[model samples]
Target: MIRVLAFDVFGTVVDWRSSIIGELEQFGKSQGLQRDWGAFADSWRGGYVPAMNQVRRGELPWTRLDDLHRRILDELLREAGIQADEDDVDHLNRAWHRLAPWPDAVAGLHRLKERFTITTLSNGNVSLLTEMAKRAGLPWDCVLSAEIFGHYKPDPEAYLGCADIMDVAPDELMLVAAHPSDLRAARDAGLRTAYVDRPLEWGQPGRYRVPFEADEFDSIATDLLDLADKL
Candidate 1:
C-alpha cells in the first residue's frame, strides 16, 4: 500500500518553463536588451541535466541546484553578451523559487494529502524547494531533496533514501513525476510510480514528450486531480 506520495516539482507540480521565460523577459526589460527570451529560457533549462550530470559523474562535488542554475545563467548571460550586477543576477536566479503551480496542482495535492502523506522528492536543494513551496503555496507535508541524500534523481540512492527518511518501505512510497525517466528510476528502486501528463512542460505540445509503454507505470493521469481520483 502506498503511504507516501513523493512529487517531482519542476515540470510536474509547477510550470517551470513559462515561469522562467516570464522572469527572463522582465530581466531583459530591466537591462534594456532584446533577445529571444523563450529560447534563452529553453537554454537555461536545457543546461540542467548536463550540470547535474557533472556532479553525478563526479566531475564536480555535490552542488546545490540553485548554484547549478546560477552557473548556467552566468554562462548563458556571457554567451548572450548580457551583463548585470551580482544582486540582479542573484534575484533573477531565484525565479525558480517563484514558479507558479499548475492549475490543478494545488487542489490535487490537497486531495492527495488527505489520503497520503505528500512531500517533495526533487533534485532541488532544501532551501530552493522550501522557498518554492512557501511562495507557491505548495502545501507539502515536508520538503525533501536530492541534496539531503547527496544523490540526484535517476539514482537509486535518492529514491531509497526518500523512503528511508519517511520510514516507509520502498514499495509504499510512490513517485509522481511527469518524466518517464524519473518514474522508471523510482520503479527500478522498488517504488510505485505514477506518471502525470504535462505535455506543455516545454512550452509546446510534444516538444519534449517521451514515449512509454501503456502498462509501464502503476497509474497515469491527465493531471494531479485525475491522479487523486485514480489513486
Candidate 2:
C-alpha cells in the first residue's frame, strides 16, 4: 500500500511560468523596464537545471535554491541590461515563494491527504517550499526537498531518502510529478510512479507533452484530481 505520496512542486503542483511572468510584469512596470516578460521568465527558469546540476555533480558546494535563484537573477539582469536596486532584486528573487497553485492542486491534495501522507519531494529548498505551500494553500503534511539530502532529483539518495524519512519502503511511496524524469527516477528507486499531465507546463500547448505509455508509469492522470480519484 502507498503510505506517502510525494509531489514535485514547480510545474507539477503550481504554475511557475505564469507566476514568474506575473511577478516580472509587476516589477517591470515599477522599474519602467519594458521587455518580453515571458522570455525573461524562461531565461530565469532556464538556469534551474544547470544550477542544480552544479551541486549534483559536486562542481559547486551545497547551495540552496534561494541562492541559486539570486545568482541566476543577477546574471539575467546583467544580460538583459536591466538595472534595479538590491532590494528590488531580492524581492524579485522571492517570486518563487509567491507562485499560485494549479486550479486542481489544493483540492486534489486535500483529497489525497485524507488517504495518504502527502508531502513535497521537490528540488526546491525547504524554506522555498514552505513559503510556496503557505502562499498557495498547499496541504502538505510535511515539506521535503533535495536541500535536505544535499542532492537533487534523479539522484538515488534523494528518492530513497524520502522513503527513509517517511518510514516507508520505496514501494510504499508514490511519486507524483508532471516531469517524467522525476517519476522515472522514483520508479527506478523501487517506488510507485504517477505521471500527471500538465501539457502547458512550459506555457505552450505543443511546447510540452506528457506521454501516457502504459508500460512507463504505474498510472497517468490528467491532473492531480484525476490522480486522487485513481488512488
The model with the greatest TM-score is: 1
Shift of residue 211 alpha carbon in model 2, Å: 4.2
Per-residue lDDT tens digits for candidate 2, residues 24-84, read 9999999998999999999899998999899889999999999999999999999999989
Q: Assess candidate 1 and give its lDDT.
A: 0.96
Q: How do the residues 66-157 of candidate 1 rate in per-residue lDDT, one tens digit apiece?
A: 99999999999999998999999999999999999999999999999999999999999999999998888888998999999999998999
Give the least accurate 10-residue stretch of model 1, judged by summed lDDT: 130-139
Error of 1 at 172 (Å): 0.3
In candidate 1, which residue ranges exceed 4 Å CA deviation?
none
* Clashing residue pairs in candidate 1 (N, C-alpha, C atoms within 3 angstroms): none
Name the top lDDT candidate.
1
